[model samples]
Target: MTTTTDSPRWFKSSYSNNGGNCIEVAANIPGAVPVRDSKNPHGPALVFPADEWSSFVSAVRAGEFGNL
Candidate 1:
């Protein structure tokens, strides 16, 4: 079996405007989620375990971060 590492397909939320502080996330990668600054596509990306990323997203959706 041949395994290939695909490139990250980063995207920010539709609600995001031209704000330079935005972050982009790539959910396409299996087992991992890559996050990076939307303003710097070519910059380094931080990879997080899929489960952890999922939990973080869920918390955000549930407003656990409190108006972030």
Candidate 2:
């Protein structure tokens, strides 16, 4: 896990309107990108490499995840 002295600053997409199904992401951390369920702010977060997270976002923008 990436340790930090400060808590993550999580945020969701402006397009998110799926009620409790939305996920939040915190990319302000120095070395990692963290993601978690928007409905469960206090729950565990999934951490990923910044590059990997960027790739995933690009793929999502490109519709590579299909109808997601």
Candidate 3:
């Protein structure tokens, strides 16, 4: 998992609202991205490579998950 040693400021998804079923992400973590469930801050974080994470974000922003 990525660490604060990389010094990334995690941000909750802007689409996150009162539902409380959202996720948070830390970007630019050198070679990886760290993501965690917003409701479980102390839980294990899932790590992804930078390029893969960017593609996921792009897919999300493009509404690829909307119909699914």
User: TM-score winner among the candidates?
Assistant: 2
Please estimate how well model 1 matches the true structure, expressed as its whole-model Cα lDDT: 0.84
Best by lDDT: 2
lDDT of 3 by residue, 1-68 (tens): 65552466778867677598888898757878989888898788898988999998799889999963
Model 3 scores a C-alpha lDDT of 0.80
Q: RMSD, each candidate, Å?
A: 2.2, 3.2, 3.5
Per-candidate TM-score against the hidden true structure: 0.84, 0.85, 0.75
Give residue 31's lDDT in candidate 1 (0 to 100).
87
lDDT for each residue of candidate 1 in 1-68, tens digit (9 for 90 to 100)? 33223566778988788778899998788888888988888888889999999999999999999998
- How many pairs of residues in model 1 come into backbone collision? 0
Q: Quantify all predictions' global Cα lDDT against the true fold.
A: 0.84, 0.86, 0.80
TM-score of 1: 0.84
lDDT tens readout by residue for model 2, 1-68: 76472578889999998777999998789878989998888888999989999999999999998998
TM-score-better candidate, 2 vs 3: 2
